[model samples]
Target chain A: MTCKECRKRFVEARYGELNAGQRAEFEAHLQGCAACAAEYRRLQQTLRIMDQREQPRLESDFGDAFWDKLAAKLDAEDAPPAPRPPQRETPARVLRMFDWPRASRIAAAAAVLVIGVLIGRYFFSRGGEEIPLAGSRETLLQPTALEVRAGDYLEKSKVLLLGLVNWEAETPEAVALDFPRYQRASRDLLQEAGYLKTALEDSRQRRLRALVADLEVVLLQIANLEAENDLSAIEMVKTGVDRRGILLKINLEEIRRAQSLPRPGQTSGKPSI
Target chain B: MKDEKELIERAQRGEMGAFRELVERYQKTVYFLALDLCGCRQDAEDISQEVFLKAYRFLPNFRGEARLSSWLYRITVNCFMDTRRKTQLQTLSLHNDAPGENHPPELSLPDPGADPSAPARSHELQQLIRRALGRLSPRERSVFVLRHYQELPLKEIGEMLEIAEGTVKALLFRAIKRLQKELAIYQAEV
Candidate 1:
């Protein structure tokens, strides 16, 4: 082989990319050529020197601390806002009922009498089909159709969170491609969560309100995640899911099963009033 | 390999414990790769942390098409490049002239042949190699670090850098030639 060919082969040989035939030819050239052999030795020595550099050692244990800090950041980002105090009617307001003008008092009494008669007539007239009016106090008190719908919304949210928490990527590229379904689901849930939030404003179910509020935050985070499947976006959504403990807190299966059981005095397939 | 795949699958599912295992398994290799690329211990540590965090963030999408180690090496390279770019202005003002100024005190080389200590000679040679590496362009430096230091094959290096295999070989050849040129004075003495 010519010197140029031998030198080219030398580079290939250094990388161990040369086949046996090429290696034999390169070795044959090296044996007869003093200059090429000397150059090869120098290259080997430089590589040996480079390899002698020590791998830097960390001074202390950092893995646990680092993971802890990351987890804390994630949790902090997902933590819900402080709950507001519950609004309630006080007895002091009841005593103020007599403070109104005589005409106002007469008008209030008449309104109440009319409402009572209407309620009595409705119960008597309906016989068995009891449909509570929307936004009624009785509807809030009993298990209404709206509550069943709310339960359904919660169930959907639970499935989304489970999918996110247990997500697996077949390839790195798959991560970005696979999140549109999640984004769409989150968007749908965000709309439902908002409606539920407004509906629950006058509700006294403090625990349910609080749960919905937390679920709203998680849904919002997921809904707003970048569609391109950005790593930071994914991390943000994952952190929100983990921070709110959504997977653990919202048990859809249990909620669905509980909601399915018959209420007292209610027949199967009959809507409770 | 199966164990690694299992750990990855678990980590993808938001299992911090499984991810931590992955971190511990690759920490040393990641640290050394960063050190070789950045030529400083503190930067290497920071870069190593960034690498694993990026890995975790991107792990969900990491289709087993490439080895986990290759994915990590790709991340390490990107992290190193990012860090170098971010710190370039500061590094210029602080350590432009002094090649080994930011090198940790523990990394200081002992006098060569002063005590006939093999370790001293090794340290001296390591310092020379680091200086030579510092003289190369970022592309050349990365190609050399991945190929020579990390012992990654040429095809893998090409994949990590998103360059052709022929380009990788060309870079490696250029890197070694540059190193030989830069370390000629030390070579003569030896």
Candidate 2:
């Protein structure tokens, strides 16, 4: 056998990975040739040296220090946030005047009612014409609500995209100044985007599904940013957002003002618009 | 083995003492694995901690599909890969040192006693091996470290890596060939 063939077999043989026939041939070649024999010995010696190389030992206090530090970190993470001081109570009259939550809820309910009525009118106008319902009864029955939710997602996505696009990194510090905000927003959006994408997987609104899928990709990139101060990563995320044309695709400002907002009920601390 | 299973179960149930026990059990092995993979003590320490923390976070989802040790090994591998990637990116901007120049500053030869030259030579060989390992791609380096240093079987390595056994063998073959080439000079000297 050639020296090259023998050397190839030697590696497997050294590890006892070769079968009987291959091992026998490798052994025969090693016995026949002085050069191959010398090479085999050298290989064995090298492996022995490698195997004997000592792994560096940690300091004796390493375990204690690691446990202490990690425990502190976990403690900090697990601690509940300090309660905000109670605001001075306003007069009952003033409180009623500025009950934004109640007003917003009422407005939201009315908007949904209007959308339902408009959708009913449109379907009635269409008479017997079949509305392609994406083969789902939920979509067929609640198309208006789904459209509103889609619009809300689109608007939120635009806000994130615009934040990235409008970020002016005049100084090095400025480059990653808003990355934490971007990362949080992207993570929040990613969860929603994943759900929407799956929900729209069989939907007939091809354009909306495609846009959501692309948006998910950008959100994932943003969410996986390794460090808060990584400017290059921020730029990469911005580039991804820009490349997907997420802001331009849906005209989110117009959609937000035109469509009734669908609230998915404060998911993952994300604010509803 | 039953004791280990119980420990994992307790740790999964948010028992910090049980988790600490798990950490104490595998700390040295994980630390050494990280140290070997990273070639830097600080990074190794960080990676080791990250691995344990990640294991804790994801433990409830563990479902006991693989051995706890294997799962921890997988986490160590992933954390090392992530740490290496970040280090490489930072190195691009902050440092221009040669490969393997990031060897742990504390890596000095152990006491030589009478044969000073022997310890120095062994240290040199170790550094050479580190440099050779640094030459490997991340995937190849992980495969090589797990096979050679960790001494995991090919099938287990495949399971840990979530790749086919044939792929593991192929990667192992490639890694060995590359290491052999890198250590060829030592082969000739020997």
Candidate 3:
């Protein structure tokens, strides 16, 4: 490539989006030209310096408080807060209404089960129809939706935290880091991690469970990173991630999951959720 | 917890929770983007609030032709630009714009060179780089920040800004050139 052509492709080259042939030509041009090489090095160094700077601190309840403040502002203007979400009745909340002893709850459940069975038998006899088991059967044949969700959660967290888990204060320029992006992703993943942890509470995925719990602590640390230089906090988080080998575990689980994916018309010997 | 598409759909239906979720998802993206373009955290926060409020109001009409993040980003840039224009006009109002009146000198802006006692912090390049970023136009700053800080593709940034990829490239090139000039002093010290 000519010097002009090579210089024009710097953006693409810096982002590693150039095709192999183009990349090869660009590298060759840089190698042969001292001016081009120096310019390229300075560009890379500029980005590295950007990376080393601390991320701007955001309030923990920033989103929540913004919504409330906006709502109040609108209310003062006599414009009611935009339509509120429909209140959802959580199953746990519904169950809490019963507030009965375990024995009494079990007895009630048994009575309901007997009554349901009798009604089902009556329907089966009268309609002479088999129960529709297809939906449940299909779900059993595949992995729990939770596994897929867990996999996705783990994959995202792994990508987001990899830079953070590996960052060392002594070698701050080791990677082209984006502290703000990591902080945001960690905040998003924090909710998913908690949900997944609770969903996996009764499951057979022990390693997956532990990994997610570890991810929670690490992600929390990342999401709450203060504005100032808090190298000690980052180091503690890094140490926790390393001690738990969370990244390695995520990779291993992914491999395990890939190997265990059920083929068409076949089901693996996987525990049902 | 919901996918972005679902969140938008629900938020459009006047669901506060869904709108909140949507905001949570892209809140920082919008905040930092504003911060980079404006070079001030307080302005960034105001811009973000305005962007989200506009999203909440006009969401029912936000046809899903574009990604929600891109739409929000476009709103952020527009909000920043509008705020900047108003501030500029307010500042300029102090001067005479009638017919052929001479403009008054800017007395509000303190000169950096006026304070020699201010430690140079020659070892610190971050402050210098941050100040240099303030010299860029809104479009140039957005292009550079989205490309580098957000790691967005050039085409994606162009689409978000409603500019052609070539224009994005030109803007980014100019921005980097400016930064390179600023960083030269630091490089010389090394």
Candidate 4:
């Protein structure tokens, strides 16, 4: 192809608008034409040369003076001042009702008032010197024998509750026949008979009632085991309480209430059962 | 005083100050392009002012689909083209004094001076190229400046000039051919 024809197609090809067949034909011609090829190379170099010329850039801050002039013109065009809207009073007024320290003082005063009322009721209700719950001799004696008997019963009951809670059968009487631990514990605790009767009647001492109810179930199981000679039932009862976390619950509540109820001689140690 | 987007928004809202701010920001660049395209300081300033005023009036109509610079470039080129159409240049022929080859004006050595060229041999050649540029058609001159001098992508030139990409490429090719002819004359003389 002639240089003129090649140049015409070259422009079309450069823009990627030439159809595939036309482009192929141009490529084939360029492969064989020296003069057209040379012109094509020169045109590419010229493009390269032009592309190398950087846009003449001034500083980014070049137009500050011109901007100032424009700004002055704009500001001059603002409308004449009009009456402004009347401001409404602020609506969120709770924050203003009390200063920080005043709020703190009111809370402290209420707390002191409550404490005073409690202290007054405690002192005024008593006929004599208000005795310390820990040091009162009579208070100490009231629950000691009862707790000792309850503790013995609880040991056996703890095992039985463990079994019941775990859905295990009662420890068998045959096993009790061999393992005499329950009978021995019951015998040793028989001296606390008087307090047991009193504890059973008192509804005010709900914690004690809960403990007794747990023990009564264990005692019945023990009696049933001995009568039936069911050794398997005894072992089952023992496993139930352990699996159910029953003893831990009753023991924890009993110790808390028992410690609060004064003992005659025993000084409270570290606030325990 | 204001950012570009803020100025554009305010101008769109019919604020003259905002439009003027944009004009101030771009005046020098428009001026330089006009001077380069028209080959005279007076013509360049007139083209630059006209471009800005037209841009201000058209601010509300600008769709903001392209960069503000691209939009401004469109205005500048269009204004130049209008002027060129009014005063159609006659394509001047040169004596083939020298016939060997060198680079085109776009590829000529960089001009570090504020003036178009320094007192150097290459500078004289640059002056000759600038004169030759004035003779080309407005479309050809624009394509040359954008493709080579502005180093704009062909697609961008198409967008600014509102022409097809193929047309831009063709015009660029023709402009380069014209430049090569003028350079060939210089080469033969050298």
For each candidate in turn, the interface RMSD (Å) is 5.0, 3.9, 6.2, 4.3
> Chain A TM-score for each candidate, in the given order?
0.41, 0.40, 0.42, 0.30
In terms of TM-score, which candidate is strongest? Answer: 2
Candidate lDDT scores, in order, read 0.70, 0.70, 0.71, 0.59
User: Fraction of true contacts kept, per model?
Assistant: 0.32, 0.23, 0.32, 0.25
Any idea how many clashes model 4 has?
33
Docking class of 3: incorrect
lDDT string, candidate 3, A1-273, tens digits = 787888898888988768999999999999899999987888888766666543445667877786787676545655666787876789986787674665454554454444344433432354544222223233332337778878877776776655565444453233334466567667767877767776787888888899889889888988998852687887888788889888888899999988788867787687655
Cα lDDT tens digits, model 1, A33-118, are 99999988888777766766665435465566656655665555557966868646588756565555554545544544443344
TM-score of each: 0.52, 0.52, 0.50, 0.43
The candidate that wins on lDDT is 3
TM-score (2 decimals) of chain A in model 1: 0.41
DockQ for all candidate structures vs. native: 0.18, 0.20, 0.15, 0.13
Query: Scored by Cα lDDT, where does model 4 land?
Result: 0.59
**DockQ winner:** 2
Q: Tens digits of per-residue lDDT for model 2 on B1-190? A: 3398899899888999999999989988998887767666677788888988788788899888788878888999899878767766221111335676554334343523324465566777876776666666677778878887888877788888889977877777676667777788876687
What lDDT score is found at residue A89 in candidate 1? 55
Candidate 1 structure, TM-score to reference: 0.52
Candidate 4 per-residue lDDT, tens place, B64-139, comes to 8888888878888888878867863222323222344122333234544335544566455556666567546677
Residue B5 of model 2 has an lDDT of: 84
